[model samples]
Structures are given as C-alpha cells and as structure tokens.
Target chain A: MTEHTVKSFDDELTHLSNTISRMGGLAEAQLAGALQALANRDSDLAVRIAASDAQVDVLEQDVQHFTVRLLALRQPVAADLRHIVAALKIASELERIADYAANVAKRSLVLNQQPAVKPVGAVINLGRLVQTILKDIMDAYVEQDVAKAIGVWNRDEEVDDLYTGLFRELITYMMEDPRTITACTHLMFMAKNIERIGDHATNIAETLHFLVVGTPLKGARPKGPSVEAQ
Target chain B: MTEHTVKSFDDELTHLSNTISRMGGLAEAQLAGALQALANRDSDLAVRIAASDAQVDVLEQDVQHFTVRLLALRQPVAADLRHIVAALKIASELERIADYAANVAKRSLVLNQQPAVKPVGAVINLGRLVQTILKDIMDAYVEQDVAKAIGVWNRDEEVDDLYTGLFRELITYMMEDPRTITACTHLMFMAKNIERIGDHATNIAETLHFLVVGTPLKGARPKGPSVEAQ
Candidate 1:
C-alpha cells in the first residue's frame, strides 16, 4: 500500500474506533438514565430512555457499515483485522447493553404505575454496579488497557452476588405480602436485566482480552453462586 | 483470482456454514433437553444440559477462528464478506441461546428439589414454543430460506404472548398459595429464559435476512405485550 492509502486506512480505523467509543458513551448514558428513572419513578424519563436505544442501534449499524467498507477497501490484515473484528463485537455488546437498559426502563414504566416495592432500592444498586462496570469496560476498550478490562471481568461475580441477594430479598418480600407479588415480580426482572447487563460487560471485557492478548481468556469465568443456586 | 484459489475459498465458506449449522443443531438439542428436563423434572438431564453448553461455546470459538482466517486470507468482498460476518453473528446468537437453555436447566434442578408447582405445565408449553422457533430459525439459516426466516421473525409475538400468559398464571398461583412462592419464582425465571431464547431466534432470523437480502430488517420488531406490561 502507498503512503497516502496507508494514511487513509489509519484514518478509517480511527473513525471506526471513535464510532464505537461514541456508542459506548451513549449506552452508558442510557443505563444511567434508566437507573435514575427507576430510582425516581420517572416514567417520562423511562419512556425517553427506552426510545433513545435507537440511537445506539444506529451507531452499531454505522460501525457495521464502516467496518465492511474498511475491510473491502483496505483488506487490512493481522492486528488491523483483529481490531476491526473486535470493534464489531464490542459494538454489538454495547448495543445489547443499551437494549437491556431500555428493557429496564420499560419495566420501570410498569413498576412506577404500581405501589413501590421495598426492593427497588436494591435493584437500582445493582443497576449502578453494572453501570460502573460498563464505564470501566469502555475505558478499557478506549485505552487498550487489559488490566482495566480484567478488572471489569473479575467484578462480574460481585454483580452476581448482589443480584443473588436481591433475588432472595425480592422473593422473601413477595412471600411476606402476596399483594406485592405483582410489583415484586417486575422488580425481580428489572434486577435480572441489570445482571444480564453485567454479563454483557464481562463479554466486552473478554473480547478486549482476546483483542489485546491474542488469546481467549483462559479457565472458567469467575462466578459467584448463581441466583438459580439460591 | 485463479480457479484453484476460487474453489478453495468456496470450500472454506462451505465449511464455515456447516460449522454454523452444526452449532445451531447443538443449540436446538440443548433447548430441547432443557424443556424435557423441566417437563419431567429430571435433574440429571438438567445437569447434563447445563454442562453441554460448553460444547456450544467451543463451537463458537471455532466459528470465530475460522471467520478470522477467511477474512485475513481471502479478503472476501460483497456476498462472501456478508456471509462470513453473518456466520459470526449467528454463531454468537446460538451460543447465547444455549446459555439461556443452560440457565433454564439450572433453574429446573432447583425447582425439582422443591415441590412441583401447578404452572409447570404452562411453562413447559412456552419452552416448547421457543424450541420450535429455534428449530425453524436454524432451518432458515441452513437452507438460506428467506421466507422461513421471516416466518421465524413473525412468530416472535406468539412466543411473547404465551410467556406473558405464563407469567400472569405463575404470579396468580403464587398470590393464591404463598407456600409456592419460591418454586413459582424459579418458574417465572424459567419462562423468562425461554422467552429470551425466542428473542435470540428472532435475532438469528434478522441476521439471515441481512445475509440473503443484503439489508437490515426494517420497521419495529413485532412484540406482544411484554410481561412487565401485565
């Protein structure tokens, strides 16, 4: 490749990375908004957060199109190929994270209509934990900091531990007051949605691990006692 | 490109597609096994199904490695590029589907230890519906049948409807008999797992549509009233 073409290719790669970074930021804001909506019982904010998911989806499509164009025009190999593929994977992960946040918002819309359950605070805490992980994983991706990614990876169990505690607490709450069954059910799902978001964050961490280290994360994923185990 | 090189590229693509088809089949079997475990309350089958998810994960890794090789070596353009990317996306979706199935299986083990709940039958039915969608979507992928894929996409609402019904029934049962709250909570999550499996099937359908039509599926995803709305 000529110097001019190589420079253009580098520019395109940078552009693709920037698109992913932008998508990550949008997803983070979406989660934060959803958590705030849940905490404040702001149905209007929840509705808007649900709708804003489309922006993340569009950015994902941009990453897809940009990557395809780069691959075809540049035929980038080795590190460039891995970088492009990782961008696609990360974008998809971020898109799903946004989707989960939207789902949480949708559930919050319903939960707000019902009487407040005691476990809402716990669910929001879980969402906040997942939100921090989302931010850290994005930073890892942007800085190519494998340690930061590993930090996010190891924190998945903390989210799970909290989710398990929340799960048991919600079930106990429901068992205590049958009237709260309907509301607690939604809280349970909201908490589960946040837990799944944590899983996706771990996924992004693993993707970054492979992208930087050029090997799959070894051994079993560090796991706490699953909610199912409880 | 020389004839020999072109032939080898076609062979590589074919191999990749076959791996995806095999992965899809394994995912289907996993869901089926999970459903059967739930239906029969067979904890042994549940344990096996959960362990078998590792196999699907390994196949996904295979798909990832193969696609990277194809992209790096072939620098495939146009249809070939889309096909390779689609395979990666589909494999990831299948892996998630298997993970959901394993989750259901894990929940089943817990539920089996508890006294059987009355709504287990309804939950099994929901799983059956999702299992069928999984099969149809896999067929759509292996046959490259757009109509079949569309069929799978359109049926997502039916799965959601059934899941919503199951959710309500389980909640009602729990409200009536507080003794069953623990068991019912497990059933609620099991149904949710199956519903998520349906969503992944729709995801596969969309991926197939894009692979064949070279365009994203347009318009809103057809969704029934979500459980949260209930």
Candidate 2:
C-alpha cells in the first residue's frame, strides 16, 4: 500500500518471474535432449535424461514455494494474482512435459536394440512442432506478448493435423506388414505423447492470454478427438 | 489468536471438501453414463451425459471462485493452505474428466450412426475400470484413506494394460476389414479418453496422499518406455 512497499514488491515479482523462466529453460532443454536421445538411439543420452530429471523437479518445487509465499505475503489481486497462477500452471505442465520427453527417450533406447522398422521421420516431425510451440509459449510468457501466445495456441491445430497424417501412415504400415507392428506401436505412443505436449503448450498460452487480457481468450470449448483415426 | 474465527474457518474448509465430493459425484456419473451409451449405442443416454456436463462446468467455476476468495480473505497457512491448493487441482482434474465423458458421448453418437465393427465390450470394460477407480479415489479422498488412495493409484497400471489390449484388437479389425476403421477409430479415442480419466483419478489419489501424509505418494516412476513394446 505504501510507496516503499510497492517498490520492494516490484523487485520481488521480477525475481520471481526470472526464477520461473529459469525453470522453463531447464524444461525446454530436457525436451530437446530427450528427442535427440531418441533420434540417436543413445542409451547414454537416455540415461542422462533420466538422471537429470531431478534438477527439473527441484526447480519446479522452488518455483511453487516462492510463488505461494509471494501470494500469501503480498496478497496480490487481479493481474498480479493471474501472473502467479499462470506461473503455477506453467510449472506443472512443463514438468509433466519433461516427463514425457524422458519416457520418449527411454523408448528410443529400447527401440535401438531392434532393427529399424520405418523411418521415424513422422515422429520426429511431431516432436519438432511441439518443441517449437513449447519454446514460443515460454517466450510469450516472459516477453508478455499476447500476440505470440495466441500464435502458439493457433499452431496446435497444425500439430494435431501432422500427428493425424502420421497415424494414418502407421495404420497403412500395420495393414501391409504385421511384422512392423512392434516398432509402429512405439511410434504411435511417441506421437501421442508429442501431441499431448502441444496441448500443454496451448494450455500455457491460454494462461498467458488470461494474464494479459484479464479474461479467457478461448471460451473453454472442448477439443474433438484426434483426427488420425481412419 | 481468535478462537471464534478459527472455528468458522474449520467449517469453511469442511464445506469446501463436501462441495468437491458433490462435484466428483457428478463427474463420475457422466463418465459411467457416457461409457454405457457408447457400448449400447443409446443416443438418449448420450444426450443425458452431454446435458449434465453444463452443471459440472458451473460447479467447476464455483469451486474456482470459492478457493480464490478463501485464499484472499483467509490467507490460509500450512495444512489449511495445502488442502485448498489440492482442492483447486482436484477440481480442475474433475472438470476435465467430465469433459472427456462428454467427448465419449459425442463419439458415441457418431459411432451409433454407423454399423458395428466389433462388440463394444472391450471399450465398455475399459470405461468400467475407469469409473470404478474414479469412485474409489473419491472415497479415498473423503476418508483420507492412504491405503485406498494407493490402491487406486496402482490400479492405473491395469487401466493401461486394458487400453493396450484394446488397441491390439482394434488394429486387427482395421487389418481384417478397412470398413471397420471408422468405427474402430471412434472406439479408440473413447478408450484413450477413459485411460486419461484413470490417470486423473490417480492424480486425485496422489493429492489425497499428499494431504493426509504431508508428502506425495511415489508413483511408478513413469515406466520408462516399454522394452516389450506392444
């Protein structure tokens, strides 16, 4: 309420934002490394991803503790409250997204032991799209760019479209050669996980939009099932 | 410091818990009815599940508003604060679970318009598993029964196994007769959604464990991709 308190609060909020961004950066790196581990079939890479997850976990907890303390101490309302909540949701989503990446890398290690079935091009493409969306979402949050956040949300449709295309192709492979079933199944899950990452990224974007506009950008409309079926 | 207000705060916390249970009941019903509708191809049942979703949405918003107001006014600390935070997370998950039920019903309406590919038995089985775990998890939350919550968390593995079996069967249908692909695909999304519902139930179970024990229950460590594949 006082001028001195306002200045101190501003400084604390800035540091809080940076702490969240640092955590985001670690999550982003985990996603990229996991995908690289998969592409290369490097078990060592997968092991490293699995091992380093604790760092992300630690950062996630730090962000949460700091945010909750800020909320309780500062009693922030309106946009300030929204920012803290956005950070909270973003932290949870990014942590889960990192877990998915670790899973994918682990699968990659497993797949390497077997003969390659088909080019993992489709799965790789899906990962790239999701990774870009994740990166852009963090950028939008840190920069406070509503336009960039909306852009991240719109790109989700494209990622879904790409995954659908890949699904159809996988189905064709299974139909033609049942032998490819094993590898193809991993591809299916890998694709699904990547699609979910895109969904999480979109969630972050929605949160950002709410922080900026003080209202939900999307009307909480339910998304239809994946288009990749037939 | 203030005995009278402290007593009232306890009552408020109790009411919040009760409200969450009421909402959880609504979501559980939606999930069960949607599954039944899909299995039986009952359009009337589908309509009912879809119609009830709006009420769940309203409850979700009410919980959101209530928790935010509680935090702002009471500025709860320690255990009280964790309970409210957990309620917020549980409310969101329950809302999303309801949305998944609506999704299943929508898919059911489409699938019903077509000829049957195979029996909806497996899809129904998966749905029942989800519904059971969801109900049990709520009970666990109500009683703060750590054992029951852990039981629900572990049951998620069975749900995953059931989903994998369904996928293999659907693949056979598509391979045998491409005509079955459309129906099978709708069925696949329904299965995926139910599996996700199981996941959310497990999440609620985790939340309960956290509240009762002051720590999170250790999960199955993400399974690290399947060496067995599918």
For model 1, what fraction of the real interface contacts is kept?
A: 0.42
Residue range A71-185, candidate 1, lDDT tens digits = 6666677788889989988999899889888989999888887988778988988888898899999999999999999999999999888988888998899888999999998
Per-model TM-score, in order, reads 0.94, 0.84
Over the stretch B19-124, how does candidate 2's per-residue lDDT look in tens digits? 8999899999999889888877899998888778889889888887788778877888889999998898899889889988887888788888779766488899
- Going through the candidates in order, their DockQ values are 0.47, 0.26
Per-model interface RMSD values are 3.9, 5.3
Positional deviation of residue B48's Cα in model 2 after best superposition, in angstroms? 5.7
Name every residue pair that clashes in candidate 2: none
lDDT of 2 by residue, A1-230 (tens): 89999999888778878877887788788888878887777789887886677787787788777877777788888888887877777888777777777667767776777678774877987898888889999998899999999888888888888887887787677667765655666677677777878888888888888888998886543354443321
Residues forming the 10-long window of minimal summed lDDT in candidate 1 chain A = A221-230
For candidate 2, the per-residue lDDT at A95 reads 78
Cα shift from native, residue A55, model 2 (Å)? 3.5
